[model samples]
Structure formats: structure tokens, C-alpha cells
Target: MAFSQIKVLPTTPLEKLGRVGTNDVYIQKEGSQYTFFYKNIENKEDESIRNFSFKNVENDFENFYKIIIDGFNANPIYDIKLELPNDYVWLHYTKTTSKLGVQFMTTNKVTQSTGISQIMSVEDVKKLFEKI
Candidate 1:
């Protein structure tokens, strides 16, 4: 489902942190709960933008966070960082047009869902894909 359907979800405000230069949002809460979201911008000359309605995937909060953020960090309220078991999966998707034909791309990255939501260096992430 979507974040909207999360049980006991928090209403998070979207902060304008300049031009999305590589930082993410960290949700701190009581108990053992954590939420994260990240996103990156892309430029394409020929590609259709798809909008999936929140009503359709309201149960995939984890997926929603990954779709928006390049990376995330979640932790317990204690003094240490906790690791999310293998149960949590993060996936990202992108569509592009190329000389061959239309390309549909997707990647699922495994991440520890604990510790600190470190603000990534946008430049570093960009260099990873050589977007810069």
C-alpha cells in the first residue's frame, strides 16, 4: 500500500531543502518504528511519466520511501542503531528512451533500516551514476 495507509502513520511535512542535493527525511518515534523517504531528479527527452495512485498501493510504505529517496537510515529510540531484518526491501524504478527502444529499468537495494539518516552528498550519489 502507500504511506497513507500505514497503521498509525505520522503526517510528515515536505521541507524544501534547496535543490534536493542528497539529503533525506528521518522519522523518529517511540517503540521500534521508523520511516524513511528519498528521491532523485532525472532528465529525459522522450519518456512518459507514470503516476501511480496512492489508493492502488496504499500498503507499500517501504516502497514509497525508496521511490523518493536515494538512501535512508532508521533507528530505534535507544542509543544504538538497529538493523532491519531481511524482511524490508527497497526498490527503485526508472523509464527512459534510447536508440534501441523504450527501456524499463528497476533496481532493488538492500539496506539496514537503522542507525542514522545521514544526509548523503548529492555530488557523491550523482557521481555513482555519473549523472553529474
Candidate 2:
């Protein structure tokens, strides 16, 4: 699961966008198909991050694009300060729009109590993926 060894599966249409620690990011779409996957290299027990697909492809893609891309485009970064020890990764599935949204907070693996945050532009995020 080394970042350098990450590769998109054949016929899957996913494009590697880079890695955050040991988690590899990807985006995929072909015609009406749209999807995303996060491969957790650190978790040898279950390498797949899971939960990207929820049966409704169209709506899921729309929401993912809206919240992760468009929402960030509109509002920029939203930060929260919490004093917690556990790390969390959350995906919000909106019932009204039938779309997906993601939120995550990372705790220093060694420190376990301190959180790490970063700010990046939408364009920068898109640039992580190799040109097709």
C-alpha cells in the first residue's frame, strides 16, 4: 500500500489523486458512472476504506461533487476545534438530495490527542490526480 505502488484497478475507471499518509485518494467516472475510493494502506486488516457506493450512482456523485468540491468552492474551509483523543472520518449521506458528503479529523497518531488540519484550494486538490 505504499503511495508509489498505488495503481488504479483495470476497467475500474478510477484515477489516483495522491495520498494522505497511507490513504490513497481516487476519483472515477465513465459515461454515467461516477465514484470515489480511499484505499487505507495503514490498515492491513481491511485495505479498502469502503462506503463510497450506496446504490444510487447519479445522486451520490452529485452530492460528492457538491459538498466536497462545490461546497468548498463556495464556502472555503470550515474548521472545528475539538478536544478529543480519537481520530474520525465521517461520510454524510444526505437524505434530501440523496448525495454524499465527507468530513474528517485526524489526530496525531503518536500524540493521540492533538489534531492536525490543513487548508488547500479546490484547484490544488484536482491537480493531485494525473491528467488523463
Candidate 3:
């Protein structure tokens, strides 16, 4: 018998954490590295997953998240990327003489798509983070 190579799609086994809107959050471990994963389901037939790496899951991640949450104190800028790994998210703030709104830009490298959330109030952003 001769040996033949088989092509397989790369997959990282994940543990489900929770879901955020159309995105499902998960955690994966690769040796000593811990990765955060998100799967965005556009429909029953289409979905994509993205990965973000974190050094210290316990302290570093918590501190970083706190810093992000605290940033709501100031007015939002036009484009500010969050400290999250792999450029996963961007904060978009719009302020006009007549209106002020907050929005987020999230990217999925695997799918090569960037999604913009609907304009929301500052409080809505805070509540969304708390769910994660």
C-alpha cells in the first residue's frame, strides 16, 4: 500500500463562552497560548470565525477590558481601534452640532468583512461589554 496525503481544513477546538448578537463567543487553548474566538453567523448557511490572542487571561484581559469600559467617559473619536488582539474592533464616534452617536466597527479577518453596528448610546455599549 502507498501512503497518500490528505488535505484537511484547519480547525481549532473551542469551548463555548456565550453569544453576542449574531456572534458566538468561544475560548480555545493551544498549548500555553489562550485564544478568544468569535463566530459570526450571518445566516443558517454562512458563518465565519475569528481568533484573538491574550497573554494573561486572568489579569491582563480584565485590566484591558476595564480600561476600554472606562474610556466611555470621554467623547468618542472618528476612529479608534480597541486594544483587543488582531484588530478585532474599532470605536466610531460621531458628534455634530445637532447629534451625537456611538457605533462600533468589528472585523472578521477570516471572512475579510467589517461590520458596523447600528448607532447606539454610550450606555448601550457599556451594557454590551458587561454581557461578555
lDDT of 3 at 32: 39
* TM-score for all models, in order of appearance: 0.19, 0.33, 0.43
Candidate 3 has what TM-score? 0.43
TM-score top scorer: 3
Cα misplacement distance, residue 68 of candidate 3 (Å): 4.2
**Candidate 2, which ten residues in sequence have the lowest lDDT sum?**
87-96
Cα lDDT computed for each candidate against the true fold? 0.29, 0.39, 0.54
Which lDDT value does model 2 have at 8? 70
- The Cα error of candidate 2 at residue 96, in Å, is 32
lDDT of 2 at 113: 36
Candidate 2 achieves a global lDDT of 0.39
Instruction: Kindly list the per-residue Cα lDDT of model 1 for residues 36-107, writing each as its tens digit.
Output: 333312333422222111211444434433333333232211122112333332222222351111111222
lDDT per residue for candidate 3 within 1-132, as digits (tens), equals 654786677975654443344445434455435555555443334555645566665677556446545555565344557655554676566766755555555775566565554454555444444542
- Over 26-115, each residue of candidate 2 has an lDDT whose tens digit, in order, gives 445554553344544344665545323223355754454445555443343344332222333332212225333333334434445322
**Model 3: per-residue Cα lDDT at residue 52:** 59
* Candidates, ranked, TM-score: 3, 2, 1
The best candidate by lDDT is 3
